[model samples]
Target: MPPRTPAAGSRLMQIGEAAERIGLSIRTIRHYEEAGLIVPSARSEGGFRLYTEPDLERLAVVKRMKPLGFTLDEMRDLLAVLDALATADDEERRTLLDRLGMFHAAAATRVAALRDQLAVAEEFAGTLRARLDHHGSCTT
Candidate 1:
């Protein structure tokens, strides 16, 4: 097995460094806050948002979900499910797994829809290429 990467240190990092670590712009992080995906652990004396290790991990989850076409609400629901799982007893763990299965089914539906849309786009591109080739022949 590969060695584990150290989690972000528990100390608060300035927004720039945290953003760099997470591969997002500070503005995007702020937008995520506005969207209710993450809340900073605390504010500095200067009133800047201060993030801790948990926040960084949460941001990583958000980043992963966004590219997978999860809406902010879906991401929040998934996070809530994960958070509940973390604190769950053995019986609750079973419930959480059931809930997660539902979430996965919904995500798969979304992925299928996206795939259909992409196939349409590919077909359009092929038609466009044929049209361009025909026009090129006429121009020549």
Candidate 2:
């Protein structure tokens, strides 16, 4: 594994605080662990998950992937590809670079799909607003 970045502070946070910091529910954070997406930085003496800044950054990546609707396997693949790219050399570096390019293309596709969905959602919202306005004027 590539070395994790040095955390700004050595202080470790429990799972709840980590979840709050990442804007995800505790259960969701646990689910990410279960999915092998992110591992806690450490375990306390009582066995509670302890998270550091690097761990939070990993969770943040998963959060961004969640919004883009990336599958668990896709997330795992991307993480592995990124890790490899960081330390790859020569031939391996070229292959990892190609993999990164594929991920970029896939992300662009997902973003375009999201844009289409958003446009449809906006039109629906506009329809609802018009109906609400009509009903409000009638009710008055």
Candidate 3:
């Protein structure tokens, strides 16, 4: 037989494998699909979502952005804007940049919110530790 193509050697992953590979629940993957963050390139013969490496990479982006406080809608919007810019002509670059500015502003806002939450959580943790230490001294 002739040499096999990479595509033949590495077929698309099923929903379960995709989830496991990305350390996300299958439901989470489905939810991302619903949110338009990731779309499977195709379906398997059994009608299961067939995720390729690009899909997995996309999920990685989604995962990274989420813990950093990006909403699914934001992620979706960002990706859509990126795809548009990437496919746009030079004349359209300016327009795309203007759109990208909106996403950047939103991301900045979310990051600020996360930072505030972190500050509050750190303060609360310190207070709790102080209380625990005080109780320990009283009980000793």
Candidate 2 residue 45 Cα shift, in angstroms, is: 1.5
All candidates in order of lDDT, best leading: 2, 1, 3
C-alpha lDDT values of all predictions: 0.84, 0.86, 0.80
TM for every model, in the order presented, reads: 0.75, 0.84, 0.78
Scored by TM-score, the top model is: 2
Clashes of each: 0, 0, 0
Assess candidate 1 and give its TM-score to the true structure.
Answer: 0.75
Per-residue CA lDDT of candidate 1, range 1-27, in tens? 111233455588778888999999999
Clashing pairs in 3: none
Off by over 4 Å in 1: 1-11, 20-23, 64-71
lDDT of 2 by residue, 78-121 (tens): 88887677788899999988988998898999999999999999
Top-down TM-score ranking: 2, 3, 1
Scored by Cα lDDT, where does model 3 land? 0.80
Error of 1 at 68 (Å): 6.0
Please identify model 3 stretches exceeding 4 Å from their true place: 1-11, 65-73
